[model samples]
Target: MSNQKTSDILISEVGPRDRLQSVSTTMPTAHKKQWIRDLAAAGLREIEVGSFVSHKLLPQMADTGEIVAFARTLPGVFVTALAPNLHGAQDAFQAGVQKITIPVSVSEPHSLANVNKTHAQMFEQVRQIIACRNAHYPAVLVEAGLSTVFGCTIQGVVEEDDVLRMAHTMAELGVDEVGLADTVGYATPLQVHRLFTRLKHDLGELAGSAHFHNTRGQGLANVLTALDAGVTTFDASLGGIGGCPYAPGASGNIVTEDLVYLLESMGLRTGVSIEKLLVARETLKQGLPNEPLYGFIPDAGVGKNFHYAGEKA
Candidate 1:
């Protein structure tokens, strides 16, 4: 945990990739860099800068390599990117990312719909990614981003046993971590608690970040449950900007600013500056003024006499 505050929670900013990909208007590469820089300045230690997928599928992330290089120049920032297969993972590692996240959906239907791969094929890809990473850049961490661990939009009611089985399989395959994602916002607090608790029990330190969508407005509530279940790392977006393109009902991710407020107000340090986070939100606005951004903390302003327990801005 040398890269993070031991006493504080780690918030991984995913807006640059997750948010931009869902929109039609490609965010300017320069604007993306500016937004990422501002986010790092706001005290976010980890950020998923972009995804290393095909340009045909996601033109917005065409410049992920350049973005990764730019993000590396920032001090104290750990840059991560999404890689759907071995090729993407190799490209991401060669581009100099600190970590790579390869998503594998627990629900077979969702996996096929999202990545055009079955569970077996996706697991094989993960194995290849791990082998490639080990052979080339052993320092680069490879994480299994378990998507649709909750119920899936395409195939509803994903079983808990499937989630656990896949998580254990990822752990057995030598993934550095396994993150649970609520791909369609079908997860409840009790469900989140039960699932994450079981995952932690199964994988221990390998059970990683919690990613939730606010489609039903339960994103923050789910985060609370994950925290109680002993999850420290969380994946959130700037101004609440994210949703799965493959999942119809999926909507925005848990808003980073409000999540930080929730953690800091409870005296759990997040090492983020709420005031500076709002400034970063403004940077996002200026870059993509037409896009709608969501967050309550920015609208209501900081509470009267609010004191941040983390590092001061």
Candidate 2:
């Protein structure tokens, strides 16, 4: 059975949205719904089900509205979606997402390439999005995910000062939270620690989740660093199956199963069932049969003496 206990950490699963958008194969709406159900059943309270992007631009996410509708039916699950602009945010609000994450790239080049907007324009869109949310869906939460905060594949060597400035701008625009994303997987542990520490010190309650990619095999190390820096929320994928579609050479998010095991073994309660998470991974594989899945715990299996954080040893 899934754990009924509350968690000390929040693992926001992003496989359905982030992973699907990057892949060429479009998972059917039914399969997407089933995958979400399985993930929630494994005790993932927050799930980024899909994005509110154009079908022509991202055909894989064409059924996002339907996915959101289905995910809303699951009890105790917080449904979230990515919305790159005012139009997408409006669609997401209408679709009933509990939270909307807007990617605000810290790198100017990345911002232009990802959403075809400058920093000022992106901030303006965020203002409009917040205005629309306040005027209509006051209950919906808005988060500005600061993409390429670590470094950019296009721009290269994004400054920490610039990232802090963008995050502060988003906060000033009325976002509920601001998260740092290693969009191209260029983050190191020391860099992650220093930035996140500064972010927490600066933003306090507004400092949000850590989104890391395993492109350089530093994802887990970065996670540990962020956790030590007082970050309790994290973003991971079911099978490490996500990367920035717009960021070249970026591949794989930190795997959900491994992340759960890491936290649980460290005596941090994530409230996720590793066995059930593995089951959810199977559901993911069934949806994208040809797609390659990555994770260590899935291959190695848990140790004989393994136990969940809150469980009696």
Candidate 3:
């Protein structure tokens, strides 16, 4: 019932950041800029351009700051980037990202492995980032993206209570939003429904996007479940490319093109133009010529009778 009408859903494209960071080949900065422009033209309002981590850690994201600066010039686009800690957050803020997402893995082993910091240490870092934002960049939104909430490849079976506790703590820490991530792609539809239902109940307006991976091929199903649970936003990669480099065997986020087609077909108003999205996909391919792109809609095409949500029928 919550998602019955033509609801406006946000599909936050993370290909420029998440997918690129996972690959060995670095996309040229010019090509990256063009890809982002094409994506924005497709009506993707929010885009995670890149991460503000060290060049040594992720050279693929070395051009994040430049990308952020370029993306900010585009009207009506909410530019975002990932920041691992206070230092990265500072860099991201300085680069003029309207929003920044900090990964906070729920599993202890994952927390240690991903960022080399325990939950307590990460919380401290988050606190510092919040103080920095409040003092200087008060307009920038800081989002805590809770990773590996469904299950972890490193630790396996993250507890729901732990996930809720982390979200509650993030809300208390003055974070703008807290989102749940299926980092290793082990979630089923029922699990997604139950967990997101609880997440929205606990965090209310602070409950943010759903980041699902198609690693186990359940991504779209999980999205439907989350939609029913009142999630209005999702994080997706352009070609179903991307994985947690730290979380082994975790590959393929939900494809943005397919996600748009799915949402539009369901009478959900995502504001993305599928025709333009396909063109953007071509640009992504041009940037990363060797990479494989995945999407059923891209391959099969929309049928003759299909109409986008809210279209005159």
Tell me, by lDDT, which candidate is best.
2
The runs of at least 3 residues in candidate 1 whose Cα sits more than 4 Å from the true structure, single-residue gaps closed, are 310-313
Angstrom error of the Cα, residue 287, model 3: value is 1.0
Q: Which ranking of candidates, highest lDDT first?
A: 2, 3, 1
Per-residue lDDT of candidate 2, residues 54-167 (tens digit): 889999998999889989999999999999999999999999999999999999999999999998899899999999999999999999999999999899999999999998
Report every candidate's CA lDDT: 0.90, 0.93, 0.91
The CA lDDT at 227 in model 2 is: 92
For every model shown, what is its TM-score relative to the native structure? 0.97, 0.98, 0.97
Tell me the tens digit of each residue's lDDT in model 1 across 210-291. Answer: 9999989999999899999999999999989788788888888999999999888877888888889988999999888899
TM-score, structure 2 vs. true: 0.98
Please give the lDDT score for candidate 3.
Answer: 0.91
Candidate 3: list runs displaced more than 4 Å. Answer: 1-7
Instruction: Please give me the total number of clashing residue pairs in predicted model 2.
Output: 0
Query: Which scores higher on TM-score, 1 or 2?
Result: 2
Query: Clash pairs of candidate 3?
Result: none
